[model samples]
Target: MRLSFFLLFLTCSVFALNIDISNSTIANGKTALLEFKKEKNISYEKIVVDKKTYKIFDNPINSEMSYVLLPISYYEKPSKKKVELFYKEAKKQKTKTLFFKIEDAKYKKEKIKVDGSKVTLSKEDSKRASKEYAEAMQIYKTTNEKSYISQSFILPLNTKITSEFGKARVYNDSLKGYHSGTDFRAKVGTPLIACNDGLVVLATDRFYSGGSVIVDHGQGVYSCYYHMSKLDVQKGTIVKRGELLGLSGDSGRVTGPHLHFSFRVGGEQVDPLQLMKLINKNLLNK
Candidate 1:
């Protein structure tokens, strides 16, 4: 990945600003880390990228800095995108603009065979799935404005990866969609842990995901663990890193038992491994 840093100073301003982006050219379905720093007294309002406004969170490692995670959707077209920073300087709002490039990701195609009923859901199952999707979307759209994570994120399980993120999925000769998450090899009763500190916003069994748990790390960052056989945490539970959240199994629409781990940053589903690396380097470990 390509990294870029920009330092700017407004004329006669009280402080100088430093902006850092994890990559100047990011691949689709990946994530980019954006950092802003100035004097301790200086504060930022929000960030604008690709016509979307995202909230800036206080850097967990450095109190003088703020950061946001930018996720490029897999469906986003390859092009040059702009980032606009909005801040206040001496009672006057100022803006700074930076540009980045998005390239196509070379994701491999995958074909898998599963139960026919899983691929073609019945009418009742389809209705249940739609309701579950809407509920999950509501949780992802709500930003808590406060961060629960103070340290770097960890993987939910330490196992071989069966399927990687962003793979084009062809289920039973029909193109369903791309894999939005990474699948880890697990047995019927393998333990699953929370990736980081978060509040359990949703914990329930659903039509497609089976037993699912969605954690809110706050500031528009969420982690999801899907297809579990058992849920150890409940909604409204505050979990720490490495805490037991559930047990993996073949509970959902899958060919085998595994853990599907994903991330949503700024309301866009991104590659989990990519997001974890960037966040640790640019925010928690900075």
Candidate 2:
């Protein structure tokens, strides 16, 4: 009885540690979760592990919650050992908790373990995958669209990010590569807003994106809002900033209700927070 009790206590203590990026043993490019526990907020530079170093991103504006998806090269392989994280804070600031999760082959192929399962995408929908990348590029270049100069991009939905961007995933038993967007957790009818004002070029239900909405915010900046409950705007419709475009829900390949938001500058998928840091929040406040 004493041994069992001790084991239970140890388990609880480990969980209470609240460390992110703990499950790195499963696969590469897994989300590294770390908590910044400190007496006060402090700005430090870089996280160092196994003599390998990583730099902290620089930005002017920031949100309460943020995440980044790194390539597989960011982590060490084999034993799936724990790597140490270092911090670079601009000023001494208090850090409460940081948590992490990694997406592996097993995680991607599994269906929703929770009850009340709803299908978001079907096999037949594959016919409409984005075959017109060239057309999207053409519209992105030829138009006098408004460029996104804001430092902080708004959350496409009102809820928290359920699934992070760039997580490795498997869809329909096929191993998909790195995730391209951030998933916002919300109910079936939560309002989905436009992060910035731009032209609605592509608005269609996709097999994977599901009830997807793509907006070109000029200067080759494009934001894709996916897994919507409903789409209120149409293609070619000019939308204003913060316009009500749709509602958040599980419309695509997902386990629960969330909005998958992705930002593309040209063809590469850069960090959404980078754009957020560039845009001024004062304009939105007005």
Candidate with maximal lDDT: 1
TM-score per model over all chains = 0.94, 0.51
- Judge candidate 2 against the unseen true structure and give its global Cα lDDT, from 0 to 1: 0.52
Residue 155 of model 1: what lDDT? 95
Candidate 2 ranges with C-alpha deviation above 4 Å: 1-125, 130-152, 171-174, 279-286
Q: What does candidate 2 score on TM?
A: 0.51
Error of 1 at 163 (Å): 0.3
Q: Write the per-residue lDDT of candidate 1 for residues 129-168, one digit (tens) a residue.
A: 8999999988888989888988999999999999999999
- Give the range where candidate 2 is weakest over 10 consecutive residues by summed lDDT: 1-10
After superposition, candidate 1 runs with Cα above 4 Å error: 1-16
Instruction: Give the top-scoring candidate (TM-score).
Output: 1
Candidate 2 residue-wise lDDT, 8-113, digit = tens: 2323333222122312333443223222222234443445444544343322123332212222332224444434444434453322222223233232322223
